[model samples]
Target: MTEHTDDTDDTIEGHERELSAVREEHDDADDDVSLSLPGLSVDRRDFMKAGAAVGAATASAGCLDALSGGGSADQETASGGAKNHKVAPGELDDYYAFLSGGHSGEIRVMGVPSMRELLRIPVFTPEPASGYGYDDRTSEMLEEEGGGYSWGDTHHPRVSQTDNDYDGRWAFVNDKANGRMARIDLEYFETDAIVDIPNQQGTHGACCLLPDTKYVFGVGEFRVPMQNDGRDLDDPEAYTSTIAAINPETMNVEWEVEVDGNMDNGDGGKDGRWFFTTGYNSEHATTESGMTKADRDWVKAFDVPAIEAAVENGDYEEINGVPVVDGTRESSLNQSDRPIVRYVPTPKSPHGVSVTPDGDYAIASGKLDPTCTVIDVEKLAEADDPADAIVGRPRVGMGPLHTAYDGRGHAYTTLFIDSQVAKWDIEAAVEAEAGSEDPIVEKIDVHYNPGHLIASESYTADPEGDYLISLNKLSKDRFLNVGPLKPENDQLIYIGDDEEGMQLVKDKPSYAEPHDASIVSADKIEPADVYDPSDYDAEFVAEGDESIERIDDSTVHVKTYVKRNEYAFPEIRVQEGDEVRITASNVEETSDITHGMAIPEYDVDLALAPQDTREVTFTADEPGVYWVYCSYFCSALHLEMRSRLIVEPSE
Candidate 1:
C-alpha cells in the first residue's frame, strides 16, 4: 500500500478532533441503541479499523477469484444456496417477455434480445368489483403520479452479477422518488418483495455481494422542500449525500456514511473499503413567475454515518462553498455546473462507477462529460493522500456509463452519444504503461441508442469474445404514448445482418416500450411444461381437404377454408428437443403478408409466401415458453395475432 499526502485542505489537527468526537459520540450511543437506528452502536474508531480490514480482505479475495477463471457458479452459490442444477455452458437465444403494467408504466427486462418483463407481483391487494371501470382516468392519473406506473422514477436496475454475494436473480431497483428498495425476483418473474429504507430518497445506483447475502450497498442524494412545501425543490442541500448498507430481505438498514458535499456524489466501487465519488452543489432555482426547478451539482465521497445523520437533519450542505444551481430551473439534473476540485480534467456530473477485477484501477463516467476518469484503486485504498491515488488517464470518446470487465482484464463501456458500444483492452493498457505509451481504448459500435447501460459479458459463442446487453430508454415519442391505445396493438423490430451493418430485418405492429433483457439457460425443460392444444382448439379445413388429422401425439394437421384468406391459430407448447412441424395451406387468393415463424431461442428464422403450403420443422431445445408471431408488421389486431410455444422436456 502506498501513502500519498492528504491533498485536502483540512489539517491533521482538525481531522484528529473530528475523529475523536465521532468516536466518543458513537460510544455513548451504544448504551441506548434503538431499533430505528440499527448498527448505530459500533464505536467509530473500531468501525473504521474493521472496515479497512474487511475492505482489504474482500478486494484480495475478489482479485484471486477473477484470476482463477471462476464462472458464475461461485456467484450463484454465494447469492443463495447452491441449486442442484448448474448453468449449462453456451449461449441462450434471446426473446421478449411482455409485462402487463396496465395503463402508463415501463416494461423492463435484462437484455435487448431476451426482453423478459419484471412484473409487479400481486401483493395481496383488495380485489376489484365486477363492474369496476378499468378505464377511469382519475385512477390512471393516481397510479402515474404516485409511482405505480413510472418504472423510471422508482428503479435503477444495474447489473450486479459479479459482486461478492450477489445472485443473478436479484436485480436492484431503487425507488428514488419514494425512497423504497425493490428486489426483483427473476426466478418467479415478479417483484417478490419491497423494503422500505429511510434516507432512501434518490436511491440512484445499487450493488450486492454474491449468492446468499441479504444486504445490498447503495448511494443516494438528498433534497429539501421549497417554501416549507414538501413538493417544491428549494433549499438544495449538498451534504445530504450518503452510502448505505441495506438488508433487502428484511428491509433493514445496516449503516450509512456521509461523503463531502459540493462534489456531485452518487455511485461507488466496492472492493475492501467502499470507494465512492462526489460532485459540486447548486441552489434551487425559481423563475420570475415563481415556477421552480431543482438544484444540480458535482460528485464527492464519504465513509457513511455522517451521510445518514445529515439526511435526518436538513442542515447538511456541500463542502468547499461550491455555488449552488437552482434545481427548480434546470431541465435535467446532469446539466448543472459547479467548480471542479482535486482530480485533473474534472468531470461533470460523474455518475456510474466500475473497478478492475484485479483491484488495480477504478473508472467513472461523468453523466454530462464525454470523458471517463480512471484511478488507482489499490493505491487509493492505501493512500494517505488523494493526489497519489490517481492512476492514469484513458479518454473515452462520447458520454460513458455503466461499465463491465471480462475477468481476463478487458473492459467494455457504452457511449450514449450515438448509442454505440465500445470495447477496451486493460491488459494492453498495462503494457502501454510499461512501454511509456498511453493505452488505446477501442470502440465497437452496436448502433443502438441505449439510455442507461446495465451490464455486458464475454460470450464463448461470439467471435468478438463479448456480447454486450444494454437498456434502451423509450424514445420521447414512444414514452408519451404509454397506455391502452385508441386502438390496441403491439410494435416489433426485427434484427438482421447486412453487408454494411445490422439492418431492420422486419417490423410488426405488436410489442411496445421494450427495455432491459437477460439471457437464461435454454436447455432446461420438463415433459410437464408442455401445454395442451385443446385449451384453444379451433376447427378449420383446407379448400380441398375434408378434415384435419393428428399424425402423432405431438403433431397436429389442420385444413384451411378458401374463404379464410389467412387462418389465426392458438398457442402451442413443446419440450426441449421436441420437433415441431406446422403445415399451412392457402385455399384462397394469394395473400400479401409473408408467413414466417421465429424461435428466438433456437435462432431459427423462416419466411413463406402466400398460396404456398409449407411445413416448417424445428427442434425447441430451449426450456422457456416463447411467443411466435408473424414477422410482417401487419394490421390493427397484430397484438392478438400472436401465439405462444411452451418448450418442455424431451422425455
Candidate 2:
C-alpha cells in the first residue's frame, strides 16, 4: 500500500472516522444474536465486504444457489422458501444486472442469484464519489452541451444487441430530464459517448436498439420546442411525439421524425422490416395548457386512427436513415419528408410499451387504467384498414406500468396501483377468440409498489433466465425502518419452468430510487479485466498516464492511478485563483478492480475502473489544506491510498 506523500492530519482524521464507522456497524450486528426478518436475505458481513468480487469476477452465468435474503426452497405459496439460488461469498453470479439509480444519475451493477451490488456506473449526474462529475472530461458530459447546466434524471437502461441477444457491447440509457442518450461500452462498462436528441426538451422512452444493431432510437418524453423555439407550452396539440435514429457505429444523429400531439415515453422498440414503439404519458407528459384531470382522462381514451393516419401520411423524405435537413422545426417537420410512426390508443394512463418475442404484438400499458393495450404488429403491417389495428386491451390490474416478455410462453406486466404482477399468455391471448379462457391467467402480489419487473433475459430475443427481479418503489414494512426515505427494495423471484407460480427469493437493498435495469447472462460479457492504456478513449485522453504534473504556472494536470492496496498520485500544491485539473485513471489489471478519489471540502469524487479515465477541473478559490483519498473500498489497505492537497495563500 502506497500514497502520494507522507500522511497529514486531515488524512489521519478521515481514516479514523471510516474505520470507526465500520467497526461500530460490525459490533452492533454482533450484539444481535439473531438476524432474521420477514422475507429478507440474511445479513452476512463476509458477503457485504468489497473483496467478495475479487475471486468471482471470472465465474460463469448459471448458478442456482440462493443468496442474500430469503430461503432457497421450492415452495408453493407466498410465504414459501426461495428456490435454489444460494451461493458462497466471492462466488460468480450467473448474470449481471445494470439498474438505473433514478435521481442519483447513475447505474448500479449487481449479480444475479446472489443479488450482490458489484459496481455503480455513473451516467447523467455528477457522482463525486466516483469522480464522475469532478473529472474534468466527464464534468462536461454532465452539463448541458450549450449551457453550464449539470445533473440529470436518468430513467431507463437498455443493453445493445447482437443477433437479438445481449451482445455485451453497449448499454444505452436515457436522461428523462435532459433528453440525452448515452452509450456505455460494455468492454469497459463506461459511458464512452452521449448524444443529445436534437429538437426535444426532455427524453423518456429512448435508446431502444434494433435487432441487427444498425440503429438505435431516442424518443422525446415531452412535447417541447421540437426544434421550433418559442412554441406555446400551453398548447398540447402543438406538441409533437418526436423520435430520432442514431447510427450505433458513430453514435451520431442519423435522422429524426415527429408526429403531432403528446406521445409521452416510448419503449424498447421492435422492428420487423419497420420500426414501432407504442405511446404513453410516462412522466415525459404533454404541454397541454392547464391539462385538467378531465383532459387527461379524456386523452386516456386515445384515438389510434389519428395516430396511424399522421404517421402514414407524415410525408417522410429521408431514406436509409440519413440526416438531410436544417436543425430547425419546419426543416425537421417538413410534413413532406418524415418517418411515420403508427399510434394505437388504449385506456389506462399508459406508461410503457413492449413487443412479444415472435414480433407479432406490441403491448402498451396505461398506469391509471385497469388493462393493457395490445397492438398486433404483423396484423398492423398487413391490415387493409390501418384504423382497426388494436389487437385487444385485456383487463389485468390498475396502473400497469411496464411489461417483460418471457420469450418462452408468457408476459409479466407490473401493476403499480395494486402492487401486483399480472401474468398472461401472450400468443394465447393475442389469438384467443372472445369467451375463450381469456389469456388472463394469474396474479402474484409483491411487497410494495413495484415499478419494473425484469424477467431473466426479458429484453433479449429469447428469455433464458430463470430469475425475475421486482424493482419496488416503496419498501414499506419489508425491511427494518432505516428512515423516512427507505431504500428501494429489489426483490429477487424465481421464474423458472414451474407452471405453478414465481416465488420471492431475496430482498436486496438498493441505492436511491431505481428506474429500469438491464440484465444479461455473465457468459454474454467478456470485458477485459486489465487496464490497457490503449483502451482509454475520450476528449483530452492521454496515451500514457502519470502522477501529478505542472502543465503551466496557473494550470495543473494531475494524473493518478487506482489499484488494489494503492492509489498512486503526486503531491498537489496550488495558489488561490489557480485552476486545477485532475485526470485520474484506474490502471488495475483485474476484473472488478475499481477505485474512486474524493477531495475533502471539494465536490470531486470519481470512479476509476481498470483502464477507464476521467478528469475534473476546479478553480482553487479558497486557500486551505485538503486531503485526497480513495472513496471506494477495493482492498484491505484501501485506507492507505491517500494524498494531501495544499492550497497556498495568494500573494
Candidate 3:
C-alpha cells in the first residue's frame, strides 16, 4: 500500500544491537540473583567470566584436569556433606591432631577407643592322637571329635575383631585358623554364631570394617599341588589363587576374584584399597602320571622338554601361565640366582598394608625386597592398569614387614631381619618443593620384631599425650635364637613423652602372640567410679618383710621394697560401697618409667612416672573378683604383675 524502501542491511544491524543489549541485561540479572544467594554470594556474571579466565590460564599453563592440584568434584560432594553437618574447621583440625601425636603409644589414636591386648584366648588344645585311641582314625576325625580343630594341626591363623554397632553387645572374631568367622557377645565373651566360608582353606590375614558392614576380606587358598610342581608358567593350570569377599553377617560368599597365582598375605585400608603380594613365574616340583622311572628321571633332567610336552599334549598347564620355581632348585635348573622376570617384577608376598589417616595414600611392605612401595589411592581407583598405580619407592632397609602412618604425616615401618622399628618423617617430604633433590626419609630406630607388628593409633587425656602401639610379636629369646620354644610374647611398647627424648614407657609382656589390638573407653562399661588404695584398710610392713600388718582402717603404707622395674599392686578386699587407696614406689634407678593401674570392673586407669606416685578413688559397687593389672607395658614379667580386688556384700 505504500512505497517499498530497501533498508534490509540497516534493519539487520539494528536487530543485532538490540540482541546484544538484551544479553547484557540478562547477565546483569543473573549477577544480581547470584549475589543474593546466602552461601554462594558470588556474582554470576563475574563467576562466569572468572571461570573462562581460569580455563584459559590453565590451558596456557599446560595443566591437565586430572593432574591439577585442586580437589575434584567428588571431593566437593564429600565436603558438602561435611559442611551440612556443620563440622567446625577447628574441630576437624583437632580430630586430626588427636590421631597424630595425641595417642602416641596406645592402640587407638583418636575417635572411639581401640582394644589393646587384654588376653589371648586359645580356642583349641589338642592331646596325643595315640593316647586318645584315635591312631587308626584319620587326623580329620580326631580333630572333628576335638570340637575345636582348625586347619588340621596348624593354628597360626590371623585373628581380627570388630564390635557390632547395631547389637552393641556383640563382637565378631575372624578365626582364620578354623576357616570360620564367629560372633561373640562382648559382655559374656561367648560365641553366638559361626559361619564357615568356602574356598577359605589355609586362610590368613582377615579384616573388617565396623558397624552394620558384616563383610570380611582376606586371602584365599593357594593351590599347593600346582604351586609345588616344577613346570613352565605358559601353561594355564599352573597357579590358582584368589581373594575372597566374605559376608560375615550372613556367613555367605559374596564374591571372589581369581588372581591365578600365589597370594600369601594381604591387608585392606579403610578406603577400600587392598595391598598384597604376587609370586613371580618360577619352576615347581611335578609328578607325571603313567610315567616310568626312566621317564621321570628324563623329565627331571630336562624340565623344559617335559614342560613343552605337557603343554603340547594338553596334559597340564601352568597356573595363570606362570612358572613356579623352587628356591632350592636354581643350580640344577641352570638358572641365575637372580629372580625371574626382570622388568615386570612380581610382588613377592606383600604382607602388611597401612593407609594414611586421611585415606589418600597407602604403603605396602614387600616380603621379597627390603623396600616398601607407596600407592596413590585416587590414581589407583581410576587407573586402567594396577601395576602402574604404585606412586613411589621408599626404601626401608632390610626386610620390611608392617607400615603405619599417623595423621601428622609421619610413617613408621618395621624391619623384620633385624627386629628394628624405624620412624620416617613423611610430612617434611610432602611439604618439600616440587622436583627438589632432598631425601624424604628420616629414620629413628626402636626395638621391634619387624616380621609381626600390628600398627595402631591412640590418644590420651592430656593435650600433649600421644602414643603409637607396636605389638611386637617376637620375644627377645626367639630373636636371640635361645629359648625353649618361647611362643612369641606380645610386647606393648609405649612411645611417650620423656625428657631424654621419645623413650619407651613400657615394654611389658602381654597375651600370647598378640597379633592385632584395638582400644575401648573405660567408661563404656558400668561402674563409672575409680579405685584408690587410700579409701581401703591400711597395712604397714618392715622394709624387707613381704607380710603386711593392718595399722589404720583407711590408710596403708608398705615399707617393703616394691622392687625396681616391677608393677606391683596390693591385694584389697572391699564391700559394695567401700573406697580404696593404694600406694607404690620403685626402688630402681629408672627415672621416667610409668607404672599405671586399672580396675576393669570399675573402669579406672591411673599412671605415675618413676620416683613419682598417684592416687585413685572409687566405690566398689560391683561384686566380683575384679582383676587389677598394670596398664603400662612393662618387661618380661609384666604378665605376672596382676592382683585381685575382692568386692564383698555390705552388711
Name the top lDDT candidate.
2
RMSD of each: 21.8, 14.7, 26.4
Displacement of residue 212 (Cα, Å) in model 1 is 6.5
lDDT values of the candidates?
Answer: 0.38, 0.60, 0.37
Give the 10-residue window scoring lowest on summed lDDT in candidate 2: 31-40
Across 1-651, the per-residue lDDT of candidate 3 in tens digits comes to 121122322332343344233223323222221011111111212211223233212211111111122321232232222223233333331121111011111111222112223322222221221111111122222244323453221212222333321223333444445444544333423233444544444555454532234455555444443443465455544444444455666545554433333444444444332333333222222232111111001001112222233335443323333322332222222243221111112233355665555555556665434445565656554444443445555545445667655445556666554344555555443343322213234332232343444333321111122344455544432133344443443333223322211222223333243354333333332211222233223232223544333345533332322433343435666566665544443333464445555665675554433433333445667777988776665667766777777877766
lDDT of 1 by residue, 1-651 (tens): 322123211232243344234333333232211001111111222212222233112211111111122222223222122222212335343422222222222324422233323233321121122101121222232243233433334334432343442234545555554545555544433344454444445655454532233346555555333222354344444324444566666545555444333222234444434345444333322231121111223334232333333345442333222122222222132122321112222343455555555556666664444445566655554555444554443444345565655454556565554333444566554344321224433343221234433322221111122223444332222222455431121211111211111111111122433332223232211112222223212232355553345567655443332222234445565556655655544333444544444445654343333343434455666788787655544456544455567767666
- Cα deviation at 154, candidate 3, in Å, is 9.8
Model 1 shows how many backbone clashes?
Answer: 80
lDDT of 2 at 560: 62
Output the worst ten-in-a-row residue range by lDDT, candidate 3: 292-301
Model 2 lDDT per residue over 336-429, tens place: 2222333344442456777676666767775644556667666665554443556565656555788887676788888665555777777676
How close to the true structure is residue 55 of candidate 1, measured as C-alpha lDDT? Answer: 19
Clash count per candidate? 80, 36, 56
Please estimate how well model 2 matches the true structure, expressed as its whole-model Cα lDDT: 0.60
